[model samples]
Target: METLYQQQARVFKALCDPKRLAILEQLRTGEKCACVLQQPLDLTQSGLSYHMKILCDSGLVESRQEGKWTHYRLSREGREAALDLLRQLTTPDAEAQSSGCACRRGRE
Candidate 1:
């Protein structure tokens, strides 16, 4: 099994690319077919597929097939989880602040 940090890192890695961010923004309005995404993003079929795999694997996006086309959309639960993770990681902990660092104690 992947460690907690490893799992978290996947989401970060998925989001690190400019193309991926753009793709997410495109998805914000609603679902889009893979073909529709290709032109605006200026990606080839393979390029879009590559990024979509990352987004889907990260749980930030979901996909379905309709005839020859693939449709993509933001995963509501996954997006919420990603938001919660961001808030948790960035928010300061009161107890940690009170404890102080060992390096500070050593200086005195």
Candidate 2:
């Protein structure tokens, strides 16, 4: 089984791409169709599809088909889960270590 760090890495890795981040910003307003996202974001349908796959797989984006077009939107539950993981990771450090996260240990 994957550890929690590995699980959260997938979502963070998905967000690390510029194209995916752009697509996510658009999604923050409301759900949008592929064609609607393509023009403004300057991404081809295939490109958008690829990013959508990553985002969807990250569990941060959800999709539905409307006729021939695919519409995408942010997944509220997934965002909550990711944020909760981050909170768990951060809160303990702020309490237990008091100095900082482990990586920063002896550096500061």
Candidate 3:
């Protein structure tokens, strides 16, 4: 089974690319067809497909097919999950997180 950190790492790794992040911003407006995305992104059909596959794999996006075209959108559950992971990273845990550093111990 995958560890929680590993799973979260996948989500971060998927978003490391600028194009992938741009795609997410585009989806925030609403669901969009693959054809509509290509012009603004300056990506070829296959190029967009490559990036979309990574986004979908990370569970940050979803896709549907209609006739010959594909539509894509941000996933609500995915956004929540990513935020929760970020919260965990930022939230304080005194003993559990301490390394006994003088400065860090002073904060507590």
Candidate 4:
């Protein structure tokens, strides 16, 4: 099983690549086929597949195989989950806020 940190890292890892970011922008419009994505992104079939795999693994993108081509789209649930994770990680805990820092206690 993936640890919580590992799972969270997947999402960040996926966002780290420029190619993957472009792929995601294309997906935002709606579902797109792998073939349709090739030209705009300047990616060969194999290149597209490489990036798509990362995106899919991150859970930020989902895919469906239709006949020969794979269709890709932004996953609404995944998007929400990613956003929630970001908020949770960035937001300060109420208890921590109240406690302040031990180092600062002597000065105050």
Winning candidate number (TM-score): 1
TM-score of each: 0.88, 0.76, 0.81, 0.86
Best first by lDDT, ranked: 1, 4, 3, 2
lDDT, candidate 1, residue 77? Answer: 87
Relative to the true structure, candidate 4 has a C-alpha RMSD (angstroms) of 2.2
Reference-based TM-score, model 4: 0.86
What do the candidate models score in CA lDDT, each in turn? Answer: 0.93, 0.87, 0.88, 0.92
Per-residue lDDT over 1-108 for candidate 2, one digit per residue giving the tens place of the 0 to 100 score = 998778788888888999888989999999999999899878888888888998998889999999999999999998998788778767755445565577888676
lDDT of 3 by residue, 1-108 (tens): 998778788789778999988888889899999998888999999999999988887889999999999999999998888888889888998878656788977888
Ranking by TM-score: 1, 4, 3, 2
Inter-residue clash pairs, candidate 3? none
Which stretches in model 1 have alpha-carbon errors above 4 Å?
none
Question: Over the full model, what C-alpha lDDT does candidate 3 score relative to the true structure?
Answer: 0.88
Q: What is the lDDT of candidate 4?
A: 0.92
**Where in model 3 is the C-alpha error above 4 Å?**
98-108
Per residue, candidate 4 scores C-alpha lDDT tens digits across 35-72 of: 99999988999999999999999899999999999999
Count of steric clashes across candidates, in order: 0, 0, 0, 0
Per-residue lDDT of model 1, residues 1-108, tens digit only: 889999887789889999999999999999999999999999999999999999998899999999999999999988988999999999998876855688988898
Candidate 4, residue 108: how far the Cα is off, in Å: 13
